[model samples]
Target: MTIRRLPQQVADAIAAGEVVERPASALKELIENALDAGSGRLGIEVRGAGRTLIRVVDDGAGIPAEELELAFQRHATSKVRSLADLEAISSLGFRGEALASLAAVADVECRSRGRRIRLLAGEVVESAAAVPVPGTVLEVRDLFANTPARLRFLKSDATELAACLKVVQAYSLLYPEVRFEYTNEGRVGLRTLGRGDATAAAAAVLGTAVAAELLPVEGEGIRGLTSQPRLHRGSRDSLLLAVNRRPIASRALGYAVEECYLGQLERGRYPIAVLELTVPPGELDVNVHPAKREVRFRDERVVFGRLQRAIRAALNGSQPYRMAEALSSAGSAWRTPQVHSAPAFAGLESVVAEAFPAAPGAEGPLRPLGQVQDAYLVAESGEGIVLVDQHAAHERVLYNRFLAQLRAGAGASQALLLPETVELEPAQTAAASDHRDWLAALGFELEEFGPQTVKLRAAPLATPAARAREALSELLQTLAHSLPQAALANAAASLACHSAVRFGDRLEPVEQRRLLEELEQAEESITCPHGRPTRLLLDWSQLKRHFRRNY
Candidate 1:
């Protein structure tokens, strides 16, 4: 067959395949267009998961009446006049194929009031159109209508709607000054008025729970906040990336974020973070993909170095917030609280009862030595006196029990008689929708109300109601960008910790006895879930050496 030019409609449809994967892709394109057009406020409305109808309204400088027809024409763009301009391209939507491709498979109506001309331009181009408006109003109906195969692959309405919100949220974080509002299925979802600070914007979108743990990051010309190492979830779902005010999913950046948290967090745990880098347009390539998700930096090392340093700074600056509580009563009678708080027991009966509850097949009964200090319970065995960290042992026992329950699929759920409704930013709502099943498995039943709200029906009864709500919000926010299974597990562990007894919580004699008994029956009562040592052992010889008695 002779080589001939492909038909325009065929070519446009083919191009659409690259940029328009689903309703969310089209929404992303339109959002970028709006941002490039200098919109400060944008509103999105979707019906039938953006398949039947999708509309984006922006208060940006609109297109001219005369150029309205040309806007949808293939390869026509105001972003570039020559091929050389590609090297220094800075605009978000520059390819000019977005509208043309969208028009091929859907009924697209674009109305624009030119930046120079205030009047609306009305025209029924090859795609679709009705009356025009003052600014830019793009309405796409019957998406993939022309292409039955593409429509066949479309997901459920809820899923697609969530995807669209995710796209919008990505842009929202990049452009802190741009206010965004989203409505889906006749319900108001997310409404974020532009705030100058990205952290403030993230809090508005991700929720205060996640925002609270985020340490402010600033260093090496890169600035952002990273979640504390202890708060790490199991995945990268919480990582958000932006380059010069544009959200791009660069793998290099993702690695950089992970590298920054190395050694600070446990092996399987990953931190939640939003990293924004400012590089010269000439030093980066934003036109790497049709979807514009990836970018190539001229100096990847610099980018990586900056990212690592910034995160390290943030983590080092902020420490976990601990609540003040009353000390043990025994400590008050001592000359100093520190001395009495040391690992020592007052009574041999208490020590023997707490540390060595009759071991199976033991030859003889064990005797207890007096407390080493207030911290450790010292017991006399044939070998020597064994010192035990009571607090660490209890933590290990609790952690093991929780892990066993989780592994056995017997994790308990305590239902709230009254359901709690949380108002989420668009991104968080999307994130929640994506992980609804995971959350359910962890004993949370949640339903999406709109683009910005979730209805939480049931939660674990043992968990505090307020902490549950906060944990859910934070987990969703952190996992918005990257949702890996490991991240989910870490998040679940955090939730468990919130409900578990703290280190300093005063235990009654009966409570302490019960806890120790339970610990004796638990497997792996030596380390916490996060790998922190649960139990510490010190012998009499070591103690005597510290006091110069052995010497």
Candidate 2:
């Protein structure tokens, strides 16, 4: 086969695909252009998750009448005119491909100054006069309309809308000086004051209650907000990182931040952080990707070390964490598993047989000897020695109970003596509003107290009152991204995880015994809801082999 040049239309479509993978990507490009144009205030509106329309109005320098048509031409740019200009680019959009690429696949209308131009599939369809305005108003309608296959790949309205909101949230945090008003389907979802206050911006995006718990992080050239050790999320989605006010994805840098919280957070938990680093433009390359959401640094090690030290210093200066109190408070609602046993172990053999049906003639039930390190239960079983992760076992037990309650629609709720108010992040608020009925079925009695704020009058029976906020936050994080098919299971798991007994919680002898009895009867006791092993077995033969005493 011989290689031939591709058609211009095909090439344009391919280029547009690279730049505008989704509605969110298109919005990102437009917002960056607006920011680079020195827009102090931005108004963003979207309909049908940006599939029907995306309107952006900014108060910035308007385009000249003659340049209006040129703006839609490929490779046309005002930010870069020379090799030197391209080498150390600081502007968010300098490639000059945003407008052209967007126009290739969608109908675009641009109005700025005293000029107006409209394009259909990258071809001029209309060019007429419009009302003079100081800034620009760009309306993108029928996105991916020309590319039928691309339009079919878009996600559901809720997921796509969440992605759009996420893009806005990132910019809001990065540019606190620029006020942002985001409207979705004619409803204002988020608004931030542009007074240049980072905390206030964070509150608008991450919710006031969450922002209040963040500790200030200040270093030589790094600054932002970070959560306390006790305040963590189920995923790293909330770990917002930017370089020189440009939001980019860097897993290495994210890991460097997480490294500072080693041992402080649980294995699967990560801190909620908004860290911005000021780096010299000459030392970074932002042209790696078509969307420019990724960048390469000249000295990754230096950045990593500085980031770790700065965040670590901030965490060190915060108030001391009370481990015992926290553990106790988290387990305040935990009750000993109600398992009936015959007097003097009369029917223990049947329980053992049920637990290990494969091991015939197995010794009776396990005898809870004691706890090791206050985290694991050491029990003597017929197989030999068994070490149980106390927390994981309890989590397994509660997961089964919560899942059953969710399925049966009979979840027992524990009412709080006094209603407590909680605020969630904007994205979380959207998720909560959509899944309010499901949350209620999971035993969360919530009332809308304010925007992104809810009053918790009751919680799941297993969830302690002190941990109501944490439980809701974890569930919301899971629900925000989980698919419809898996939402209920994930919510049940989140509820179980928050309500279960925590590691390091000292258990009394009776409690430990009751826990073992419950585990013996659990539907699935080998692993917890998150797939972590709940118990480990050490057979007598292996122990004898290790000791070299095979008799």
Candidate 3:
């Protein structure tokens, strides 16, 4: 077969396919164009998730009537005039493919006034017989109508709308000086006024709940913030990133964000963040991908390091809820003791004594705080209060025990009274099967029953039967992902939480005292596994201030 040129319309439609994946993508391109045009106020209205109609009105420097047609031509751009301009790309939509691609697959009607023309003179001009306005007004309709395959790939209206909102939120952070309004199906969805502060703009887009949880992130050169540990969500979709005012996604940056909060958050949870990095345009490569999602920095490691520091600083500065204090308060007959001096182990001794008072030369440090609030332990002595997170402590204890048992080949496992069977997804079953030896060493006996089921014959005797099943399943999942040994420590902590007595659970004074004694014996009793302080020291000065007696 002889090679021949493709039809112009077919070629154009194919080009559109590259840049326009869905209605949201189209909206993103238009918004970028408006922003590049120095739009101070943007209004967006969508119908049918931008499939039936999408319109964007911007009050900016308008294009001349003659240049309006040129705007829809491929490679025609006002943003660049020479090859050197590529090195310092300052505009958001410099490629000039957006309007051409959009017009190729949909009906695009645009009207604009020239800088020399009066507003009244250019108010009623027509383009393809479409109505005109003073500033730029772009109307896109019947998107992907000519390409049915594209329509098939599009998600539902609600999903597409969510994608559109995400795009708007990202850009909103980059240009806080521009007021933005979005309307879907004739109902107002979001409105962000020009605030000139990125955090304030983010709050307008992401809502106050997320905004409140976010800690301001500012590095020496880069500026941004990451969300607190408790505010982490299931997906990394909440990351809003902009490089020199251009909204783009970088996998390396995403990984850097995850690495920053590696120890702070649990498995499968991602922190929400909006990061703005300002580097000289010449030091970055923006033309790496067709859609321009990925970017390459001159000093990739430097960028990653900066991101890590910013996120870490933000997390470190934020206040975390003290779970151990809550547990101690819930326990009956527990009192916070005062510290008169700063001894080497004053605080630890006080914590142990309060948690577990000595009975005239008690043996082996009062049996170590076992479990308080069903998750932590309280031990008190003369120095202060020692609040221990049972889960973290148990994790450390059990990890060493499990490792020793594995090496000794004499690990003990207690037979279950009744065999327990757990059903998992095929992937989970595969993950569990791969880590059978590790499970055995951890004191879990398991055998595959069917395609997606496992039968458990025994579990660690130290762990409660009620919590064994959940712990086994969690361990299997963790092992499947090849998580580090540190993850097992976290799992152990979770297990301790499940088996320990919980807050609001009525406990006799003796039981509470016994739990406190156990905490005193445990090492690292100052905090829980998650790094929350186990005990809070309210000083005499603070107490006086609370009662207004200091004056």
lDDT of each: 0.66, 0.81, 0.66
lDDT tens digits, residue span 1-551, model 2? 99999987778989999999999999998999899989999999999899999999999997888999999899999998998886778899888899999999999999998889999899989999999997899999999999999999999998888889889999998899999999998999889999999988888887664566678999967999888765666778878899889998999999999878753555677788889998888888888988888999999989888899899899877652311011111210111112243243335343322221112113248899999898999888777767788998898888888888878877788899998988889888998999877788778999999987999999988898899889998899999988886788788888888988888889999999998888878764555777555765556654555555778
Q: After superposition, how far is residue 288 of candidate 3 from its true place, in Å?
A: 2.0
TM-score of 1: 0.59
Q: Candidate 1: misplaced stretches above 4 Å?
A: 1-4, 114-133, 321-551
Candidate 3 ranges with C-alpha deviation above 4 Å? 114-134, 322-389, 393-551
| lDDT score, candidate 2, position 218 | 95
Ranking by TM-score: 3, 2, 1
Rate residue 469 of model 2 by lDDT: 84
TM-score of decoy 2:
0.61
Cα-lDDT of candidate 1: 0.66
TM-score quality measure for candidate 3: 0.64
What tens-digit string does per-residue lDDT give for candidate 1 at 242-300?
88767778787788788665434546666667778888888999889888888898989
